[model samples]
Target chain A: MSTPRPLTLIVNGEPRALQVEPRTTLLDALRERLDLTGTKKGCDHGQCGACTLHVDGERVLACLTLAQQAEGRRITTIEGLAGPDGTLHAVQKAFLAEDAFQCGYCTPGQIMSAVACIREGHAGSAAEIREFMAGNLCRCGAYPHIVAAVQRAARALEQETLA
Target chain B: MMDFSYARPADLAAAGAALAAGGMALGGGTGLLDLAKLGVARPVAVVDLTRLPGLDAIQVSETEARIGALVKMSRLAAHPAMRAALPAVGQALLASASPQIRNMATIGGNLLQRTRCAYFRDAAVGSCNRRNPGSGCAAVGGVTRGHALLGVSPHCIATHPGDLAVALVAFDAVVETWSPNGQRLLSVHDFFLLPGATPGQEFALAPGEIVTGLRIPLAPVARQARYVKLRDRASYEFAAASLAAGMSLGVDGRIADLRLALGGVATIPWRARSVEAALIGEHPTPAAIAAAAALAMREAEPQPDNRHKLALVPALIERTLTDMVGEPA
Candidate 1:
């Protein structure tokens, strides 16, 4: 194994400097090092989207990203989705309003991806939302409600933009 | 996963040097990292190529387009110029993987992606010739529902698992690479190798060579292309049988030019040159398209469990070609 390297990541709007082994993934860094445990590890492979997050505003699988590869990039986890003043993000509110989760294992990843789906303009229709958010899988079978939440959030965001 | 050092080279020359020293070049790390976790790939060091300049540009012109190898799959799928010029490229990219993966995977890595054969992925299978040449093939008699049909041998039958390469091959795209010997261009058809006696030798890329870019010529057929993918699920799954068909019709409604390729059914992206010849200058009727589609898979050799692909491939081609002749939706 190689020696631990010093790396800095701008995680959740904060610059965090840490020493990590070369094999450590960005998912592991967020969960173990920074204690941001909201990012779940479903498969630890790229197939599952339980570790979805935004790296430079692009929704990517964190487990497939090496910690070293994320140096000097903006990282946003599920915990960082809320406003600094303690208000929930519009997408999060829609998820709660629609009761879009069961067993809640895939909630964080679902909400994160839903937020990105709307921002990426894939929320034009319910079918389109489902197609775009196909990466995040919920074993508990809350897909219908999740799609509704995404649609609702998309409308809310558009209204906010118009205002 | 193995713990290996990572180096981010500042330039292509340094990247070539790093790769020459027995290191694997890392693109988006979507494929490499997944293989590492599965214990399939364990390199000594990973030379990061994203920092290198001139390998991430996507240039589009009226006649052609040059897409850098490091360009992400998501960007390529959503580029306005690329979507307008070569719609099949976007269609193929969108049909592949999922949104999150497309955001992370690069074009170079996608072309070089390993097969998703169940036997090859499971190292414990101990019979995958692609993973261990001459070890024998378990999929030949085992679970072959997802194996190859167009190109197969006794040694290996793993299907190539990329969608973009399928579309690129139909257009005669050229892959540009850099090495100590300078730069070289390889046609997409000759770039991927059949899993013959040497299933381990998957690509023509040398150990120290790095894919720099891809050049695709724009033809009238390119604008009228469509990709049809049939899979177990509607989204986020590998194709059971996919077809990419493109052609331009003359004012009289006859085929002026055509290109066709198949995915999820071959050891490499299978270009149907025979089918192209059958369609050119002919009016595309249902019967005519069906006859041509049958000729495309005349040489297909399928395993017991995957013989259905022989039927599925032609049906998909006929449908895609028929749709291509109709009004654009």
Candidate 2:
């Protein structure tokens, strides 16, 4: 057997060094080796947003990113968005209130990308938010609800700041 | 998917050396990794360019904007400089795959992404000329609605699948590449080639060369440019037919200059020089644009399933150009 490759990744605010195959994607590394299975593997290809995560504060498809290329970068998975005392993030709360998911397979990616969308100021219009979030495929056809959730989250966050 | 050795190079020189040392250069990996997972591309070693410094900047100036090959399409589309310098490029990027894929896909990778031909995707087909050279092209008599109407050869009829590259070609973009020998630049029009008789060799890059940046010359015409992609679906689907047109009209409402390039209908991004030549110095009326578009589609030899493109091409061009010109004064 060949020697495994050494990879150091900062996942969910923690640094981890592991020996993995060169074919290990960041999604696989998070799910298989590090046991952070919150990031789903919907298509395993880049087509689906089930593997979306924030790398260096920008949304990226973890399914296409190599584990070895993530060195020294801040990776924010779904698990990282919660408070220290385990309170839900604003986006997650809005999603729950909006009933944004049915099967919930794509909820994590949707919520993650929704938070980024609001933070990036792309939540101005429903159409714009829909266009921005088109990458994360929710096969359950929960698009209307998802968009409503993102809008609600943006409004709630704005009100909190104003208060 | 077979495992391989991976290396992260620090700079273009190091990446070129790594490529010369028999490692496949990986950029974005949206295409390469997908092919690898499908068991199509199994390189012995991979050279990752994610950490390579100075290759991700989108620099804009009065004359031009040099887009680093590693610049993600999402960032490129969202960049204020790109929005101001060339809105057509940003429009094309926005029309591409969802925001998630754009975030991970790079400009260079977009240029080099493989075709969406089903036969080519299925390794078991065993007759895709692109996958296995000299294997008969199954697309010829098969479901050829997505096949090329221009630049179709006996060997292959796969259409080039990039929207932004088509617009870049119309903008007269230059591709800068780095190799072990040295650096070289190629016009975007020449970077992608028609398959002709040999469909295996798709791009013009040398074995060890890596695309460093794309230089898009700033032209006043770009301000009035448009990239219109018509497809079965609004998102995630490849173009059924598309047009990238940039034009400048004279004071008399006539075409002073024009650059028209097409995608989803050719083996390469089809630059309609004939149409552009005819449109220049002509009135920007629907009749004139239609006549030029007719000239553009004169040599199109469409497959049985794609003959609809012959009609769609002209209409798309007219609508796209008209939209760019806005209502007549």
In candidate 1, stretches whose alpha carbon ends up further than 4 angstroms from where it belongs are none
True contacts kept of each: 0.88, 0.72
DockQ of each: 0.88, 0.71
Best by DockQ: 1
Q: Note the chain A TM-score of all models in turn.
A: 0.98, 0.96
In candidate 2, list every pair of residues with a backbone clash.
none
Candidate 2 per-residue lDDT over residues A1-163, each given as its tens digit:
3467787888777889998888788999999999999999999878889988999888888888888777789999999999989999999999999999999999999988998889888999998898788888999999999999999999999998999
lDDT of 1 by residue, B47-160 (tens): 988778877899999999999998999999999999988998999999988899999889988888999998888867888888877889999888889998888888988988
lDDT value, candidate 2, whole model: 0.86
TM-score of each: 0.98, 0.96
Worst 10-residue lDDT window for candidate 1 chain B reads B320-329
